[model samples]
Target: RIDAETRRILLLELQVRPGIAALQSEQLVAKAFKTKVNMLRSLGSRVVMTVLEEVLPAAAREAFRKATSSSGAAGAGRGVRPAASTAAPEPMPVAPEEHALAARPPPAAAPPNAPQPAAAPHAE
Candidate 1:
């Protein structure tokens, strides 16, 4: 039998940090409480129904129900398409000279000891 006190604690923890749904579902709740997937599923459904039906106002519950129903209907009509199946095109072959040219870096400047070209004469 599930412990009411432990269930309330787990539900409160899940509500306090909504982003922890994955951890709550996959590991924490099950590991800590020694519960199985079916139990977790039933507990989650009951928790959700309690919040939606008992905690929420009548107007809010109706709106939420309508939204959920609409989204379910919309999802039924949609189908996911497989990714494009085309193979990648082969790379173009580079010419030998082009490859050699691309591999070489620009030549470095001559050393200071090396003779320099004479500068053009300036007008007075």
Candidate 2:
């Protein structure tokens, strides 16, 4: 009886996990669509990121970045100024030959000892 219950539970779990994942995916897609529409509405027309970067002045861009980065950290909640820490900002190392960050390899496959899905019971 316990074995049958365990199999039933596993089957239900397999079905439910996929359904939950699908619902979450749909919600994310809807959010992305809404955000894109809002961006288009605010911009007055569709504009690529590169075009905006080229058009906007460097000072304006830097000010925008600073405002965005600082707002959540310092002005979150009641808009109190956050205390500054003494730690120095870490420097990002770039590849001298490529002038860009190093590329990461794809994720490794599951280990040999990984648990695999149980086989479906025969309908007979």
Residue-level error in angstroms, candidate 1, position 62: 0.2
TM-score of each: 0.24, 0.22
* Candidate 1 lDDT over residue span 41-84, tens digit each: 55554456566797899999889767655877566423333456
lDDT for predicted candidate 1 compared with the true structure:
0.66
lDDT of each: 0.66, 0.57
Report the C-alpha displacement of residue 15, candidate 2, in angstroms. 22
Worst 10 residues of 1 by lDDT: 74-83
Off-target runs (Cα >4 Å) in candidate 1 are 1-47, 74-124
Global fold similarity of model 1 (TM-score): 0.24
